[model samples]
Target: MSREEVKLPDLPVPTALDADEEAEKNLTTAPEVPVTPYTPSAVTPWSQDSGVATLTADTAPGTTVPVDDLPIAVGVPEGADPAAIDGDWKVDLAAPAASQDAGVSGMIMRVTPPADADPAAQVSIAVDTAGFADLYGTQAAARFGMVLLPNCVMDSPDSGDCAADGGTTTMSG
Candidate 1:
């Protein structure tokens, strides 16, 4: 018995890449971003001189839309490069459930905890993102999230949306 020889498929030669063009295509420089500055507004009179802060102006007529009403940001955020991401990332929000999260691109995926006994839910995200390299912040590490906001988990899941219970957040790290 004789074995038949196998022939390897012919592969095309890769063209040499121009450093300048390659750098440009890789988005070394971000596109122009618009700046929207916040303007100060006049303070409203207090209902009480001293005590709990209460607005004297009638704000009851104002309307508010439900958080659940808004659609999820399933689409990649403006200027985000989904193709740039290529790794599994895990962020421990330390909550019973993953309420909500937003990033440059992709979705938050619930992952099985390393240990079944671990009650804390785990979620997977994507790192190595682009389109936000110009943002103000120190990127000491190679991998970083362009933007991630896992909303506060409410004590009662049935109460309302996570955004509703996330009351009074004046500062964020």
Candidate 2:
């Protein structure tokens, strides 16, 4: 069939209202609002601490004792990116190649991040026992119990204390 082209007619435009007439017709007196004077309440200053001895110590020369250094040590790479390392991390445990031990029976990993990080941020962790099956038997890996403890200063989870804030992942293989 042959098709014929159709032309559409132009739409009519709306007329604009007169500025004076529109303003006068829409004008109305607004209700009066009551104004209240602002009066601040009296505030009391915090009291200073009084001098009181809570504990008495009679010191001698040989009263102190020292302990040995910690076993675990964490060293960041010399040129590691700060931003790249700031996040949740997971570690897999497997027997060392050079070690004569049967497999990794137990291991502990400690991670310390830079100070000034947000404490409200969630601490996520995952212990991967899949790698242990290669070195150790699958039964041993399944029997192992994993524990993660995150410590913070003042025991406050909301305080972003990076010095005492670190998480430890331990597995008893």
Candidate 3:
């Protein structure tokens, strides 16, 4: 005896209204969101004491203070003409000459005094920019004491592969 094959009927296609209703049902009804008006507050300047600077702001959390508003002073020594110093300042970390082969193994910021300025002049560095967090991670800027920038290194000093002949040297962070 041969068995007969049973065929199933196809589902009916949804109409436009049905589709619209389905969409409407799936959509989330936006809750009544209350809007809050922003009110500006007074700006509190940063204060420094005993080489430690404290930044205080009245703005809401996650708000960044403007870079120009930071109270950072790079003190030039007395009788040193600020005009003689180079406007282009470069900051980096350097290891001692004995540790030059080790490259910058530590976090010490060395800022180059302006060219033509007094070599013995005192210089102060302050950083309060948004990029500060990105550049130094969570490290405090005050922890980095000033040091004379060292000559560039060709490669990782710890790598033990740096060329003896002074090849093109790049400053390691």
Candidate 4:
């Protein structure tokens, strides 16, 4: 008759529930958020840009000269009417294809967009910075533009591997 019996009820060890007090006592069962009502997509006319084009001839290091008309600032499709998106506005300066490791001799230089910047969403080109200071000497110059949108034209044009758009400045010697 050796029994160590009859002992019960002293429970208090289940911890782990204070996610902000179960989301302030809502007792967790959340997640179903979606409010929807803004619908606005499908306005692609033209867009392909690059920046920085100063030194409009004569900073005098080697005689600068790197602004053959390049003004690009676009975005007008909300209510749409930046003057019916102005003129034909074609711009084709392809790339620096003049060989000799791109020292200048490329083609496709169809430009126009500076009649006082017309309606002003912007699109200006006239890049032919002749001899651009004996091949990039005065520093700073990069202009790669592609903006020809008659009406809803979308062509990726396969650049696949990529490395055509250019940029290289700060070379004074």
Per-model TM-score, in order, reads: 0.19, 0.24, 0.27, 0.20
Clashing pairs in 3: 86-114, 101-157
Which lDDT tens digits does candidate 1 get at residues 15-106?
99656744545446678899976432322211111111111112122221111211111212234332232122222222212222221222
Question: Which residues of candidate 3, in runs, are more than 4 Å off?
Answer: 1-110, 129-144, 147-149, 153-173
Q: For each candidate in turn, give its C-alpha RMSD to the true structure in angstroms.
A: 22.2, 26.2, 17.7, 18.9
lDDT of 3 by residue, 1-173 (tens): 33566666898998764345445456577899999864323222223212222223222232222223333334433444444442444444332342434443233333444455556644445445333422333343435444443243322443333444434356671
Evaluated at residue 72, the lDDT of candidate 1 is 14
The better-scoring model by lDDT among 1 and 3 is: 3
Which stretches of model 2 miss by more than 4 angstroms? 1-104, 119-122, 134-136, 148-173
> In model 1, which regions exceed 4 Å deviation?
1-110, 115-126, 130-161
Better of 1 and 3 by TM-score: 3
lDDT of 2 by residue, 1-173 (tens): 33465666898999997567545566578988999864323222111111111111221222211111222222222343333334322222222331223122444334333344344432322334443433344355457564443343113333453232324223552
Each model's backbone clash number: 0, 0, 2, 1
Q: CA lDDT, every prediction?
A: 0.29, 0.33, 0.39, 0.35
Estimate candidate 4's alpha-carbon lDDT, on a 0 to 1 scale.
Answer: 0.35
